[model samples]
Target chain A: MGIRQVANTEAPALTAAVDVRDLWMAYRPDEWVLKGVNLRVPKGQLWVVMGPSGAGKTTLMKVLAGLLPFQRGTVEVMGFRLRGDLTPPSRRVVGYIPQQLGLVRGLTALENVLLGSLARHGGLGPTLGFFPRSEVTRAREYLEMLGLGDKAETRVFQLSGGERQRVAIARTLMQDPKLILADEFVSDLDLPRAARILETIRGLVRERGLTLVMNLHEIQLVQELADHVVVLKDGKIVYHGPAGTLEWSSFRALVEAEDGRTGVAGW
Target chain B: MAEPGSLAGKGRDVNLRRWQGLSGALALLAALGWVLGRMGFFEPGRLTGGLVNFGRFAAELFPPDLSVLPVVLGALIETVEMAFAGTFLGFLLSFPLGVLGTRTLFPRPVVLAVRLVVAVTRTVPSLLWAVIMVIVVGLGPLAGTLALAVYTVGYLAKLYAEILEGVDPEVIEAVRGLGARRHHLVRYVLWPESANTVLSQLLFMLEYNIRSSTVLGLVGAGGIGFYMQVYISTLAYSRLATVLLAVLVVVVVMDVLSAWARRHYLLDT
Candidate 1:
């Protein structure tokens, strides 16, 4: 009773943007992909989830995005608890950038970015491929912020991998969500390009006071940018702490341990 | 405990199967040849006689009856109208039926039922559909128009279903994550992704309906084919030639226009 009271007393010291408690998820019955996981991100911070292939990184992101239903425990994002019945928070509250970037290949970069503003305009105007002039101007501003102002009319299929990644970030920014979830959205780019894009995303997160949870394999970028880090292996959190506290050698050993046990490749 | 020559035995068995397959194919070919012979397909005298009769008929069809130009033009207009109305009506219904038929959008039972209906409708030829409509609507352009519309619904529904089903799943997931409703998916994802193919298919269907509408009038469904039936009954070969010429000209023009429209509006390049 004394410990419970103490825990309750300290709960208000930090406001949590994402609070996940004892979460369990699976695609099939009795075959768990995420066994037991707990995570917490402060109101305005960038958190990186790192793991080897098939370590439930993508699965965790999907759960947080409300794309997948969980079997056990509670997941609360932006103060609203996610329902076990697969109901998600309002789309305006959570922005998700999928692994493939999820930009419509046939649509222009501007149109794709404008898709982020869909939840804001519930009228028939946007439904018929029409957007308010102000929204269009804002979408252009987002593109310009991402250095894609010149290519706004270019189709997504015509854009390079790095360019496509920037467009996706712009789209997410246009969502005006308090929380952003990205799943390996930049693992394909070169060092310079990835860093440039990461800087843009990190800048926005700081300016807007948005909480970000991204899945990445790059320890260098994670060390440089992430405020907190969570290392997952086989659906379990092996390490969870502030980014500055974890040593690079120990983090590398934890990620590389599974490479010898299973034939799966690791970073 | 295996036989010493089992490998050799397997080789012989394979060779025997190959010989059996070759013999079966030869027997099928011989059967086909015998049927063709019985049907008089190789009779030289029958072929020569047919050619001679065709030549004589062709001789009489020349200098086609120019006096029937006004009649042929009016019938041509009616045929075009029927095709246009039918295509428009079919497009209106096809989009919804197509959406319902897609497995990605609806449940298995719903998709199966919609596909079954579309399949049964498609199984009946457009000409037969026109005949049925003529019986019900008492023989006019309305029957022809309804027939083409029904055929278009069956044809375009299946096409639209396949196109919608083929939309990139990742795009759909992303859009849904944005809190897009079903109508948003249709208008934004499905429609834009498949606009070129859908437009091309619609134009092709229009062209096909125009060509087929010429035959609807034979059943008194009000098109140029009515004049064809009249020409045949009255042995007016010259007038028949004129109608054929008009149909040929219209078909060529429709083909060219369809091609141009597809290139200009549908293709990205």
Candidate 2:
């Protein structure tokens, strides 16, 4: 209750860009996967949602991104309700770097990045595949910042997993989204590459004031990078507070205790 | 547990015995046919009469005629044009129909209906279509082209749906993640991932359509086959040989070009 008051009071001063309450989704009926889950994200803040497999962290991220629907909850992004059939407009503000780093292998890095602008611009810009110079420059700038500028013409299939993930991040960033959701995006990366992704998200959250919510398997990353940590188990919130406020041992114990509990199934 | 296991083992033995009986019956049918052939009961009686007429026919067709080459070439060009025009039309039309037929995207009933319709379309061969088309349009290259086009649509749409089914959904998910609308998803993501695969299939279909185009001419449609029919009817065997040679050359060229296209564009990273 004290934590809720603190978060609520902080919400207005800090950016309360995302508000999710009592969310539930079951791909199969009578088998509830996400049972009454809730979380709040202030704008310009970095929040990490951490849990083991089947913990519903990814599902929560999907719901936040407006990619998946929830039957029993209300989701408001940037003060807009993501409900009913209002998905297309709501999804416009939510940028996502999915865990699988969904890169199209047939296209080169530049073409893949250029595809981001297509969603907003539609076909009005260019009939041929050539995009506008400014849009191309922006894509180049993002790739350059990610150290992939030289590899712009390289096919996506030739890239390493970490490189592909960076490109995915660049694609999402191209949207200049109000809120960013990255779902276990760094799981396959080596430690250094993983750190790079985290740092990039950190800078995005702090400098650009973008609301960032990331699903993670790594508990330590919460302490190192997150302003707030929302720990989940069996599709329910186990803890939600400032990262510094939670006791590390107590959180670990709750996670360990969950292993003995009956598992939740739907993804 | 023991009785169940023994019962299962007995069931397996019975199944094997039944399969053995089927194979034995098939072998007996083959042996009976061979024995009949050995007894001269299945001799080439049809071939003997056909050959006697063919010998008399061949003697009159000779002194090779060069004057007919011009007419044959014109018909041959028309046939080639029909093949190209039909293949292009079919390839273009199949894209949207194939999307409708994809089970992943469509409801069960829609996919089933589309599948049933496409299946029925493929059953009517190009030659049969040429005959039906001739009834509508009167015998000409237009009938041949339209018939081949119909055949191409049947084949391309069916194969296109299968190729679409095999496309990796990961790419689609990525595009979906970007919040792309339906058209963009299909145009950018789906087409690119499956383009090479579709291109390879398209080349093979072109080659097949070319071969079928010749037969389309047999029903008074237009092509090398019309020439083959004409010279044969008029006892111009040498002219028939010339027409056959022209077709063989054109077919070989189309084959090489298709193969080259498949190599150049389809087999790449």
Per-model DockQ against the true two-chain complex: 0.50, 0.39
Docking class of 1: medium
For candidate 2, lDDT tens digit of each residue in B35-128?
9888875777866887899897776556556687888789878888998998888888877778778765678898888878888889998899
Runs of candidate 2 with Cα error greater than 4 angstroms are A1-11, A84-86, A123-130, A241-253, A256-267, B2-69, B103-117, B232-238
lDDT of 1 by residue, B43-119 (tens): 98988998999999998899899899999999999999999999989999998899999887789999999999999
Q: List CA RMSD, all candidates.
A: 5.7, 6.1
Candidate 1: Cα lDDT at A45: 92
True contacts kept of 2: 0.44
- Whole-model Cα lDDT per candidate? 0.87, 0.77
What shift in Å separates residue A214 of candidate 1 from its native position after superposition? 1.0
Q: What is the lDDT of residue A225 in candidate 2?
A: 81
lDDT of 2 by residue, A64-177 (tens): 776676788877777667763424565567787778877788888987887777667766443256678998999999899888999999989888887788788788888778
Q: How many clashes does each candidate structure show, in the order listed?
A: 0, 1
For candidate 1, the per-residue lDDT at B145 reads 98
